[model samples]
Target: MKKQIFGFKCAFKGIIRTINSESHMRFHIVAGIYVMLFSMFYSFSPTQYAVLVLLITSVMALETVNTCVEDLCGLVADRYEPLVKFAKDAAAGAVLTVALGAAVIACIFFLDFNVINTIFTFFAENLLYLIFLLISAVISAFFVVLGPVGIKEKFIKLKNRHLTKG
Candidate 1:
């Protein structure tokens, strides 16, 4: 039991590290969150939800694997080598393929005109929620572009600057 718990803990730690270090992973995470939020506007069968979950996980897993491959290639090659480049490209390509596949799945599930109209009506009815959604979008944009570590560093710098000013 303890060993299993440790394994889970390590897995979480690896995910956290990857999110901090890999911008692409951050983008996928943000996109996944948006997908989940949009999904809330529609009712899905349990099996459909499960499929969505699987698709999300598959994208994340591929992104993590790609990160690992790129890191390993970096370590193995001090400078540019064609084989290392090929390995890195292949891993990235796998991630892209999975992500695009998920997008296709999303389109199949979400591309109904009635559903799109319903989503628009929902936002139009709930302006406060729309504001919240906008705020979340800005935050998600920052998260994907700057990353958590970059955001923390920026906040720390701002705090220090304010302290010096005061």
Candidate 2:
């Protein structure tokens, strides 16, 4: 029993490491959080919630698997190899397919065409708000590309350099 519990703990640690190391995993996590928050705004039936849970779990799990596969491929070849390329590409393709499927499912379940149109219309009418939204998106993209910790480290380095110059 202790061994089983330890194994589960180790598995969870791996999941955490993957989340920290992989930008796409972090993006998926953020997206999942947003989806859960958005879901609360709607009165989803139990079945719908269950479906959402399943979809979220599958996408996250598949992404973790892809990370593992990519890591393994990297280990298998320090330099370029066709087999490694195929393995990495295949893993990425799997993740992309699942992510796309999840997006379609989300749109079908949560978004209406009219709602999308209204969003675009509102942004069009409110150009300043749209500019702010775009800026926020760019910041988010930077944060996602460089993990939060990486961004903090860069900021700290810049600050220290300026202090030394002064």
Candidate 3:
């Protein structure tokens, strides 16, 4: 039982590590949060929510798997190899395929011509929320570009440097 629990812990750690290391994973996470939050504003049926959740997870899981595959390939082939290149490209292609499918699913499930009008209407009246959303998006973009792990590592290095100087 302890062994199984440890295995589960390791699996979760890998997932977290992937999210911390991968900028695209961070983007997926931010997009997923936005999807769930925005869905609250719309009267989505439970069925729609279920489908959206599945699609979101599918994209995220595939991305994680792709990362794992790329890492594995890199480990086995230290030098540039055509086989490794093909394997990495294939993993990336899998992610692209899933992402494209998810986009189509989202369009079918979540978007409509009226959604634009709804957004404009809401922003026209709720200026504060719009500003908040813009700020949130900018922050999210930073996270996606720098990644959580990168930011933490930089902060730690800065702190250590300051401590040494002090």
Candidate 4:
């Protein structure tokens, strides 16, 4: 029993580590901000919220899987390998699949008058919430872009420094 518990704990820790990694965490944070904004603007019916939640979760989950696949490929192949390329591409394709489906669902939900009317009503009645949503959207966009660009730039600089030293 103790051994089983320990094994479960280890697996849980590994899951947490993967989810908390920079790329996965950045996407999760952005998804969370979008969820909050959506909640502020509209009160989704139970079915609508369920669908929205599932869509968001699917996107984030696929993104995490994509990151894991890329990381595994990098670890296995020090340089480029055809199999690694295929694996990474397939993982990315999964994310794109989920994203496209979610986009369609979002259009269906948002284009309806019921959802739009609720959002407009909320905006008119709750000025503070609307302001908060705007501010959060701006900040979320900045962080989402900044995180990846900063990491990419840092890696490029490091590579250059190593080349100079060599």
Candidate 5:
């Protein structure tokens, strides 16, 4: 029983690592945050919430699998391997497939149910709030991309200076 528990724990850790390592995971996390805020502001039925959760999970899972495929291809392929290119393309295609499905579901839910209309009405009534949301999204995207690069470069430069001094 102890050994079985240990095996399950290791597998869980591996799954977490795969999800966390994928770049798309960041986007999924942002989407999840949006979902949470939306849910809090707009009362969704239990079924709607369940569907949203499943859709988000499916997209994130596809992204994680795509990352795994890319990692495997990199491990096996040389700089100019045709098979590696094929593998990477196939993995990306899978993610695209999931994304397309998610987009359809989102349209069905948001458009068919007039959620977008309601949001637009709210924004029209309160332009300041809409502007705040747009500004926040822009700032978040900017920091998400550039913040890590700045930190990495700073660390690299600090390490080089330390090495030279030593």
Candidate 6:
């Protein structure tokens, strides 16, 4: 049990490392969060939600594998080589392929005009909720683009600037 727990921890650590190093990973995570959130606004069957979950996780897994492959190839090769490039590109292509497929699936699942209008009306009627959602989205954008470490470094720099000013 202890070994299994440790293994899970290690897996989570790898995911965090991937999120920090890979912008695409962060983007996928952020997008997935929002997708799941909006998915709740629509009425989906249990099976539909299960499929969405599977597709989301599949993209995430492929992205993690791509990162691992790219890192391993870079570690193995000191200089540029055709094979190394081939490996990295193939890994990236895999992520892209799945991501595109996921998008298509999502569109098919949730592109109802009535549901979209209802979603729009939901925000329109609840201005406060809309404001909060927009705020969260802006923050999520920063998380996706700058990443956790980058955001922390920015905060540290901001504090230093304030100290210098004082």
Would you list the C-alpha lDDT of every candidate in the order shown?
0.91, 0.84, 0.88, 0.75, 0.74, 0.94
* lDDT tens per residue, model 5, 1-166: 9999999998777666764455466666667667656565456789988988888888877777788888888888768788889989998898888878877876666653566677778878898998987896886564445444544687899999999999
Where does the lowest 10-residue lDDT sum fall in candidate 1? 40-49
Query: lDDT tens digits, residues 1-166, model 2?
Result: 9999999999999898887688998788778766875676566899988988888888889889999998898888999999899988999899899899989989888786665576678779999988986886677677678877778898999999999999
Off by over 4 Å in 5: 1-22, 39-43, 112-114, 121-135, 143-166
Compared with the true structure, model 3 gives a TM-score of: 0.87
lDDT-based ranking, best first? 6, 1, 3, 2, 4, 5
How high is the lDDT of residue 92 in model 6?
Answer: 92
Task: Evaluate model 5: give its lDDT.
Answer: 0.74
lDDT score for candidate 4 against the true structure: 0.75
- For candidate 6, the TM-score is 0.96
> With candidate 1 superimposed using the best TM-score fit, by how many Å does residue 143's alpha carbon deviate from the native?
0.6
Using TM-score as the measure, what is the rank order of every candidate, best first? 6, 1, 3, 2, 4, 5
Worst 10 residues of 2 by lDDT: 33-42
Better of 4 and 5 by TM-score: 4
- Cα deviation in Å at residue 159, candidate 4? 28
lDDT score, candidate 3: 0.88
What is candidate 3's lDDT per residue for 1-166, written digit by digit as tens? Answer: 9999999999899889999888888888999889887777677899889988998888899889999999999899989999999999999999899889888887776777687578778978999989999999998987998888777888899999999999
Candidate 3 regions with alpha-carbon error over 4 angstroms: 153-166
lDDT string for model 6 (1-166, tens) is 9999999999999999999998898989988998999998888999999989998999999999999999999899999999999999999999899999999999999899999999999999999999999999899989988999999999999999999999
Candidate 2: stretches off by over 4 Å: 113-142, 158-166
Candidate 1: the clashing residue pairs are: none
Count clashes in each candidate, considering only residues at least 3 apart in sequence or on different chains: 0, 0, 0, 0, 0, 0
The candidate 5 region of ten consecutive residues with least summed lDDT is 142-151
